[model samples]
Target: MFITLATLTDVPELTALINASYRGESSKKGWTTEAHLIDGQRIDNEGLAEQMEDPNAVILKSMDDAGKITGCVYLQMRGDKLYLGMLTVSPLLQANGLGRLLLQAAEDYARSIDYHTITMTVISTRTELLSWYERRGYQKTGDVIPLIITEKFGILKQPVEMFRLEKTV
Candidate 1:
């Protein structure tokens, strides 16, 4: 496995992998699916390109033996903290340690940049995912933020709140 910064040329595949890992029928193969909570494309090429262009942000991708991206996480610098989000592992590869490896890479990136904290927001309804993070040393900050809804973000069938989690690096 190899982990590297995602380039613009990888956006389309990254977008599809993200959607399949988080929402849609393909996501159902993994325990991380949000298909029951929202319905729509997880991200579009335009949005992904914007993220790739953000100077303070980066998307780290994990490649398989065949050189195919199989897992990834989005990281952004937020002052002293690195905001981690959109962590995706191919449904077929979930629970096989790739997620943890990506997370370790994220922490390494944080330390390299001198950031002392890492923060991420999880959907309140995703208890299992939150638990997994807790096991990894993240603690809930008890800060609930209203979900941000945009045209491409997907439809919220019910009100969704984001629970903030933080870890001091």
Candidate 2:
């Protein structure tokens, strides 16, 4: 397996992979599924394209031996810190360490760019996931943000809040 920068051609597959890993019935196979909390596509091609257009952002893809994208993470330079988001792994492949590897890749990228910290947000109710990040050294910054309800972000089954987490890399 290897990691590399994602290009425009990766949007379709990446979008499907992300959606499947986070929502719908397909996501039920993994522990990361947010299907119960939201009921629409997690991300679309256009959204991915828009994020890719940002000069300060990059999406890293993890490819298997056969060259299939098995995992991915979106990282962006935000002021003096690197913002990490959309970290994903194939549902069937979760817990096999791919997520951890992708996170490490994000941290490595941050350091390479001379950034001293990495930040991300997590759904406040996702206790397990929040604990995972906390175990990895991320701390709650006590900044709670309301979930943005929109066609692009999907309809929330219930009101949800997100909190910022940061770590000094």
**In lDDT terms, which candidate is top?**
2
Model 1 over residues 1-169: C-alpha lDDT tens digits?
9999999999989989999998889999998888898889788899989988999999999999998999999999987789999999999999999999999999898998899899999999899999999999999998999887785878877888989999998
Worst 10 residues of 1 by lDDT: 148-157
Candidate 2 weakest ten by summed lDDT = 146-155
Candidate 2 per-residue C-alpha lDDT over 1-169 given as tens digits, one digit per residue, 9 for 90 to 100: 8889999999999999999999999999999989999999999999998999899999999999998999999999989989999999999999999999999989988889899899899999999999999999999999999888696778899998999999999
Q: For each of the candidates, give the backbone clash count.
A: 0, 0
Instruction: Mark the regions of model 2 whose C-alpha exceeds 4 Å error after superposition.
Output: none
Once fitted onto the true fold, the runs of candidate 1 whose alpha carbons sit more than 4 angstroms away are none
Q: What TM-score goes with each of the models? A: 0.98, 0.98
Q: Supply the global lDDT for candidate 2.
A: 0.94
